[model samples]
Target: MIPVLALIVGVVLGVILDPTVPAAVEPYLPIAVVAALDAVFGGVRAKLDGIFDDKQFVVSFISNVLVAGLIVWLGDQLGVGGQLSTGVVVVLGVRIFGNVAAIRRHLFRA
Candidate 1:
Protein backbone atom coordinates (compact mmCIF):
# COMPACT_ATOMS: atom_id res chain seq x y z
CA MET A 1 0.00 0.00 0.00
CA ILE A 2 2.72 2.46 0.89
CA PRO A 3 4.68 1.69 -2.24
CA VAL A 4 1.59 1.98 -4.36
CA LEU A 5 0.79 5.37 -2.86
CA ALA A 6 4.36 6.49 -3.45
CA LEU A 7 4.16 5.41 -7.07
CA ILE A 8 0.95 7.35 -7.54
CA VAL A 9 2.38 10.42 -5.89
CA GLY A 10 5.53 10.20 -7.95
CA VAL A 11 3.54 9.95 -11.15
CA VAL A 12 1.36 12.90 -10.14
CA LEU A 13 4.42 14.95 -9.35
CA GLY A 14 6.08 14.00 -12.60
CA VAL A 15 2.98 15.01 -14.53
CA ILE A 16 2.70 18.32 -12.72
CA LEU A 17 6.40 19.12 -12.91
CA ASP A 18 6.95 17.91 -16.46
CA PRO A 19 10.55 17.18 -15.73
CA THR A 20 12.87 16.87 -18.68
CA VAL A 21 14.68 13.63 -19.31
CA PRO A 22 18.22 13.72 -20.62
CA ALA A 23 18.27 13.24 -24.36
CA ALA A 24 20.61 10.28 -24.09
CA VAL A 25 18.10 8.43 -21.90
CA GLU A 26 15.02 9.12 -24.01
CA PRO A 27 15.22 5.89 -25.97
CA TYR A 28 15.42 3.68 -22.91
CA LEU A 29 12.51 5.18 -21.00
CA PRO A 30 9.79 3.03 -22.47
CA ILE A 31 11.73 -0.19 -21.85
CA ALA A 32 12.40 0.89 -18.29
CA VAL A 33 8.72 1.60 -17.76
CA VAL A 34 7.74 -1.77 -19.12
CA ALA A 35 10.30 -3.45 -16.90
CA ALA A 36 9.05 -1.57 -13.87
CA LEU A 37 5.50 -2.60 -14.63
CA ASP A 38 6.67 -6.20 -14.91
CA ALA A 39 8.27 -6.01 -11.48
CA VAL A 40 5.20 -4.38 -9.97
CA PHE A 41 2.87 -7.03 -11.27
CA GLY A 42 5.23 -9.76 -10.16
CA GLY A 43 5.30 -8.28 -6.69
CA VAL A 44 1.54 -8.13 -6.59
CA ARG A 45 1.33 -11.74 -7.61
CA ALA A 46 3.77 -12.75 -4.89
CA LYS A 47 1.67 -10.90 -2.33
CA LEU A 48 -1.44 -12.74 -3.44
CA ASP A 49 0.41 -16.02 -3.14
CA GLY A 50 1.55 -15.28 0.44
CA ILE A 51 5.21 -15.04 -0.56
CA PHE A 52 5.84 -11.34 -0.71
CA ASP A 53 9.29 -10.21 0.42
CA ASP A 54 10.27 -6.58 0.65
CA LYS A 55 13.93 -7.19 -0.07
CA GLN A 56 13.11 -9.37 -3.02
CA PHE A 57 10.71 -6.83 -4.41
CA VAL A 58 13.18 -4.00 -4.05
CA VAL A 59 15.95 -5.96 -5.69
CA SER A 60 13.70 -7.12 -8.47
CA PHE A 61 12.49 -3.61 -9.15
CA ILE A 62 15.96 -2.13 -9.32
CA SER A 63 17.44 -4.97 -11.31
CA ASN A 64 14.59 -4.95 -13.80
CA VAL A 65 15.00 -1.28 -14.53
CA LEU A 66 18.76 -1.52 -14.84
CA VAL A 67 18.70 -4.60 -17.00
CA ALA A 68 16.06 -3.25 -19.31
CA GLY A 69 17.97 -0.03 -19.74
CA LEU A 70 21.20 -1.91 -20.36
CA ILE A 71 19.60 -4.07 -23.00
CA VAL A 72 18.32 -1.06 -24.85
CA TRP A 73 21.68 0.64 -24.60
CA LEU A 74 23.48 -2.37 -25.91
CA GLY A 75 21.01 -2.69 -28.72
CA ASP A 76 21.67 0.90 -29.70
CA GLN A 77 25.40 0.32 -29.76
CA LEU A 78 24.97 -2.82 -31.85
CA GLY A 79 22.89 -1.21 -34.57
CA VAL A 80 19.85 -3.31 -33.68
CA GLY A 81 18.18 -0.94 -31.27
CA GLY A 82 14.71 -1.20 -32.69
CA GLN A 83 14.66 -4.96 -32.83
CA LEU A 84 16.03 -5.40 -29.31
CA SER A 85 13.66 -2.86 -27.87
CA THR A 86 10.74 -4.65 -29.42
CA GLY A 87 11.96 -7.97 -28.03
CA VAL A 88 12.39 -6.57 -24.54
CA VAL A 89 8.98 -4.95 -24.56
CA VAL A 90 7.30 -8.08 -25.83
CA VAL A 91 8.92 -10.30 -23.21
CA LEU A 92 8.23 -7.99 -20.31
CA GLY A 93 4.71 -7.23 -21.49
CA VAL A 94 3.91 -10.91 -21.64
CA ARG A 95 5.18 -11.43 -18.09
CA ILE A 96 3.24 -8.43 -16.85
CA PHE A 97 0.02 -9.64 -18.43
CA GLY A 98 0.57 -13.10 -17.03
CA ASN A 99 0.97 -11.65 -13.57
CA VAL A 100 -2.15 -9.56 -14.07
CA ALA A 101 -4.12 -12.59 -15.08
CA ALA A 102 -2.93 -14.42 -11.97
CA ILE A 103 -3.90 -11.46 -9.80
CA ARG A 104 -7.33 -11.31 -11.37
CA ARG A 105 -7.85 -15.00 -10.86
CA HIS A 106 -6.83 -14.75 -7.24
CA LEU A 107 -9.06 -11.78 -6.55
CA PHE A 108 -12.11 -12.80 -8.54
CA ARG A 109 -11.89 -16.59 -8.52
CA ALA A 110 -12.96 -16.53 -12.18
Candidate 2:
Protein backbone atom coordinates (compact mmCIF):
# COMPACT_ATOMS: atom_id res chain seq x y z
CA MET A 1 0.00 0.00 0.00
CA ILE A 2 2.72 2.42 0.94
CA PRO A 3 4.81 1.56 -2.10
CA VAL A 4 1.83 1.95 -4.37
CA LEU A 5 1.18 5.36 -2.90
CA ALA A 6 4.78 6.24 -3.45
CA LEU A 7 4.54 5.26 -7.10
CA ILE A 8 1.53 7.49 -7.58
CA VAL A 9 3.32 10.28 -5.85
CA GLY A 10 6.37 9.71 -8.03
CA VAL A 11 4.43 9.98 -11.26
CA VAL A 12 2.74 13.17 -10.20
CA LEU A 13 6.07 14.54 -9.16
CA GLY A 14 7.71 13.47 -12.41
CA VAL A 15 5.10 15.31 -14.41
CA ILE A 16 5.56 18.40 -12.32
CA LEU A 17 9.33 18.16 -12.71
CA ASP A 18 9.61 19.46 -16.22
CA PRO A 19 13.21 20.27 -16.89
CA THR A 20 12.32 22.95 -19.41
CA VAL A 21 9.93 24.69 -17.08
CA PRO A 22 11.37 27.30 -14.77
CA ALA A 23 10.33 27.11 -11.16
CA ALA A 24 11.97 28.62 -8.12
CA VAL A 25 10.79 25.98 -5.69
CA GLU A 26 9.99 22.73 -7.47
CA PRO A 27 13.56 21.52 -7.51
CA TYR A 28 13.42 20.71 -3.86
CA LEU A 29 10.42 18.46 -4.21
CA PRO A 30 12.28 15.17 -4.53
CA ILE A 31 14.35 15.92 -1.49
CA ALA A 32 11.27 16.44 0.61
CA VAL A 33 9.56 13.30 -0.67
CA VAL A 34 12.63 11.14 -0.21
CA ALA A 35 13.15 12.44 3.29
CA ALA A 36 9.55 11.80 4.16
CA LEU A 37 9.60 8.28 2.77
CA ASP A 38 12.72 7.47 4.67
CA ALA A 39 11.22 8.80 7.86
CA VAL A 40 7.98 6.95 7.37
CA PHE A 41 9.42 3.63 6.22
CA GLY A 42 12.45 3.64 8.45
CA GLY A 43 14.66 0.75 7.19
CA VAL A 44 13.77 -2.28 5.10
CA ARG A 45 16.24 -5.09 4.75
CA ALA A 46 15.28 -8.71 4.57
CA LYS A 47 16.69 -10.53 7.54
CA LEU A 48 15.80 -14.12 8.46
CA ASP A 49 12.38 -14.98 7.01
CA GLY A 50 12.29 -11.56 5.29
CA ILE A 51 12.43 -9.61 8.50
CA PHE A 52 13.38 -5.99 7.79
CA ASP A 53 16.27 -4.03 9.18
CA ASP A 54 16.74 -0.29 9.44
CA LYS A 55 20.45 0.07 9.18
CA GLN A 56 20.79 1.56 5.72
CA PHE A 57 17.38 3.17 5.61
CA VAL A 58 18.11 6.07 7.91
CA VAL A 59 21.56 6.66 6.48
CA SER A 60 20.49 6.50 2.87
CA PHE A 61 17.41 8.63 3.36
CA ILE A 62 19.37 11.54 4.73
CA SER A 63 22.12 11.07 2.22
CA ASN A 64 19.83 10.78 -0.81
CA VAL A 65 18.25 14.18 -0.28
CA LEU A 66 21.45 15.92 0.72
CA VAL A 67 23.54 14.21 -1.89
CA ALA A 68 20.97 14.65 -4.60
CA GLY A 69 20.61 18.31 -3.71
CA LEU A 70 24.33 18.73 -3.54
CA ILE A 71 24.67 17.02 -6.88
CA VAL A 72 22.07 19.32 -8.37
CA TRP A 73 23.75 22.32 -6.79
CA LEU A 74 27.05 21.19 -8.19
CA GLY A 75 25.45 21.05 -11.57
CA ASP A 76 24.11 24.53 -10.97
CA GLN A 77 27.62 25.68 -10.14
CA LEU A 78 28.88 24.00 -13.27
CA GLY A 79 26.04 25.61 -15.19
CA VAL A 80 24.16 22.34 -15.56
CA GLY A 81 21.61 22.08 -12.80
CA GLY A 82 19.18 20.49 -15.16
CA GLN A 83 21.65 17.87 -16.20
CA LEU A 84 22.58 17.18 -12.61
CA SER A 85 18.92 16.75 -11.75
CA THR A 86 18.61 14.26 -14.54
CA GLY A 87 21.45 12.29 -13.07
CA VAL A 88 19.95 12.44 -9.63
CA VAL A 89 16.66 11.32 -11.08
CA VAL A 90 18.45 8.31 -12.44
CA VAL A 91 19.70 7.59 -8.97
CA LEU A 92 16.25 8.02 -7.48
CA GLY A 93 14.97 5.72 -10.15
CA VAL A 94 16.53 2.90 -8.20
CA ARG A 95 14.28 3.65 -5.27
CA ILE A 96 11.31 3.61 -7.56
CA PHE A 97 12.37 0.17 -8.70
CA GLY A 98 12.59 -0.99 -5.13
CA ASN A 99 9.16 0.40 -4.42
CA VAL A 100 7.75 -1.50 -7.35
CA ALA A 101 9.40 -4.65 -6.12
CA ALA A 102 7.93 -4.20 -2.69
CA ILE A 103 4.53 -3.45 -4.09
CA ARG A 104 4.61 -6.49 -6.31
CA ARG A 105 5.74 -8.78 -3.56
CA HIS A 106 3.12 -7.50 -1.19
CA LEU A 107 0.35 -7.75 -3.73
CA PHE A 108 1.43 -11.17 -4.99
CA ARG A 109 2.24 -12.80 -1.70
CA ALA A 110 1.01 -16.37 -1.72
Candidate 3:
Protein backbone atom coordinates (compact mmCIF):
# COMPACT_ATOMS: atom_id res chain seq x y z
CA MET A 1 0.00 0.00 0.00
CA ILE A 2 2.69 2.43 1.00
CA PRO A 3 4.80 1.53 -2.01
CA VAL A 4 1.92 1.99 -4.38
CA LEU A 5 1.02 5.31 -2.82
CA ALA A 6 4.59 6.46 -3.00
CA LEU A 7 4.76 5.49 -6.62
CA ILE A 8 1.65 7.48 -7.38
CA VAL A 9 2.91 10.49 -5.51
CA GLY A 10 6.27 10.28 -7.18
CA VAL A 11 4.72 10.07 -10.60
CA VAL A 12 2.45 12.99 -9.88
CA LEU A 13 5.31 15.07 -8.60
CA GLY A 14 7.48 14.18 -11.56
CA VAL A 15 4.77 15.13 -13.98
CA ILE A 16 4.14 18.41 -12.22
CA LEU A 17 7.80 19.26 -11.88
CA ASP A 18 8.87 18.15 -15.33
CA PRO A 19 12.39 17.55 -14.14
CA THR A 20 15.12 17.52 -16.70
CA VAL A 21 17.90 14.98 -16.85
CA PRO A 22 21.45 16.20 -16.97
CA ALA A 23 23.06 15.69 -20.33
CA ALA A 24 25.80 13.51 -18.85
CA VAL A 25 23.34 11.26 -17.04
CA GLU A 26 20.72 11.21 -19.76
CA PRO A 27 21.98 8.11 -21.53
CA TYR A 28 21.60 5.90 -18.50
CA LEU A 29 18.22 7.11 -17.31
CA PRO A 30 16.01 4.74 -19.23
CA ILE A 31 18.11 1.72 -18.30
CA ALA A 32 17.99 2.72 -14.67
CA VAL A 33 14.23 3.11 -14.84
CA VAL A 34 13.83 -0.33 -16.35
CA ALA A 35 16.07 -1.81 -13.65
CA ALA A 36 14.10 -0.05 -10.94
CA LEU A 37 10.84 -1.32 -12.36
CA ASP A 38 12.27 -4.82 -12.41
CA ALA A 39 13.07 -4.54 -8.73
CA VAL A 40 9.70 -2.99 -7.91
CA PHE A 41 7.74 -5.71 -9.65
CA GLY A 42 9.85 -8.37 -8.00
CA GLY A 43 9.20 -6.81 -4.62
CA VAL A 44 5.48 -6.70 -5.28
CA ARG A 45 5.48 -10.33 -6.28
CA ALA A 46 7.40 -11.24 -3.16
CA LYS A 47 4.91 -9.34 -1.06
CA LEU A 48 2.09 -11.31 -2.60
CA ASP A 49 3.97 -14.51 -1.87
CA GLY A 50 4.42 -13.56 1.81
CA ILE A 51 8.18 -13.18 1.58
CA PHE A 52 8.66 -9.48 1.17
CA ASP A 53 11.56 -8.04 3.15
CA ASP A 54 12.01 -4.31 3.36
CA LYS A 55 15.74 -4.66 3.68
CA GLN A 56 15.93 -6.93 0.67
CA PHE A 57 13.70 -4.66 -1.33
CA VAL A 58 15.84 -1.62 -0.59
CA VAL A 59 19.00 -3.46 -1.45
CA SER A 60 17.53 -4.81 -4.63
CA PHE A 61 16.34 -1.41 -5.74
CA ILE A 62 19.61 0.34 -5.10
CA SER A 63 21.72 -2.42 -6.56
CA ASN A 64 19.62 -2.71 -9.67
CA VAL A 65 19.96 0.98 -10.42
CA LEU A 66 23.64 1.06 -9.62
CA VAL A 67 24.51 -2.05 -11.58
CA ALA A 68 22.48 -1.06 -14.56
CA GLY A 69 24.11 2.33 -14.59
CA LEU A 70 27.52 0.77 -14.20
CA ILE A 71 26.92 -1.54 -17.12
CA VAL A 72 25.90 1.32 -19.34
CA TRP A 73 28.83 3.41 -18.24
CA LEU A 74 31.16 0.57 -19.00
CA GLY A 75 29.58 0.08 -22.37
CA ASP A 76 30.09 3.73 -23.11
CA GLN A 77 33.77 3.35 -22.37
CA LEU A 78 33.89 0.36 -24.66
CA GLY A 79 32.00 2.07 -27.46
CA VAL A 80 29.12 -0.40 -27.22
CA GLY A 81 26.76 1.66 -25.11
CA GLY A 82 23.82 1.14 -27.43
CA GLN A 83 24.17 -2.61 -27.53
CA LEU A 84 24.65 -3.01 -23.78
CA SER A 85 21.78 -0.67 -23.02
CA THR A 86 19.56 -2.78 -25.23
CA GLY A 87 20.74 -5.94 -23.49
CA VAL A 88 20.02 -4.48 -20.09
CA VAL A 89 16.55 -3.44 -21.17
CA VAL A 90 15.85 -6.85 -22.62
CA VAL A 91 16.94 -8.69 -19.49
CA LEU A 92 15.15 -6.38 -17.09
CA GLY A 93 12.04 -6.40 -19.27
CA VAL A 94 11.92 -10.17 -19.01
CA ARG A 95 12.20 -10.03 -15.23
CA ILE A 96 9.57 -7.33 -14.99
CA PHE A 97 7.12 -9.29 -17.13
CA GLY A 98 7.75 -12.47 -15.18
CA ASN A 99 7.13 -10.72 -11.90
CA VAL A 100 4.01 -9.05 -13.23
CA ALA A 101 2.72 -12.41 -14.42
CA ALA A 102 3.24 -13.87 -10.97
CA ILE A 103 1.51 -10.95 -9.34
CA ARG A 104 -1.41 -11.28 -11.74
CA ARG A 105 -1.74 -14.95 -10.91
CA HIS A 106 -1.73 -14.23 -7.22
CA LEU A 107 -4.27 -11.45 -7.51
CA PHE A 108 -6.66 -13.13 -9.96
CA ARG A 109 -5.86 -16.82 -9.43
CA ALA A 110 -5.96 -17.18 -13.22
After superposition of all CA atoms, the RMSD between model 3 and the true structure is 0.8
Model 2: residue 6 alpha-carbon error in angstroms: 14
Q: How many clashing pairs per prediction, in order?
A: 0, 0, 0
lDDT value for model 2? 0.62
Global lDDT of model 3:
0.96
Listed in order, each prediction's TM-score against the native is 0.96, 0.54, 0.96
lDDT score, candidate 2, position 99:
64
- Using lDDT, rank the candidates from best to worst: 3, 1, 2
RMSD of each: 0.8, 6.7, 0.8
Better of 1 and 2 by lDDT: 1
lDDT of 2 by residue, 1-110 (tens): 67669879988987898555347546766654654454334343232226554665556667766777777777778999887777667656666666656655665762
| lDDT of each residue in 19-110, candidate 1, tens digit only | 89999899999899999999999999999999999999999999999999999899999999999999999999899989999999999998
**Alpha-carbon lDDT, every model:** 0.95, 0.62, 0.96
Runs in model 2 with CA error above 4 Å?
Answer: 1-26, 31-51
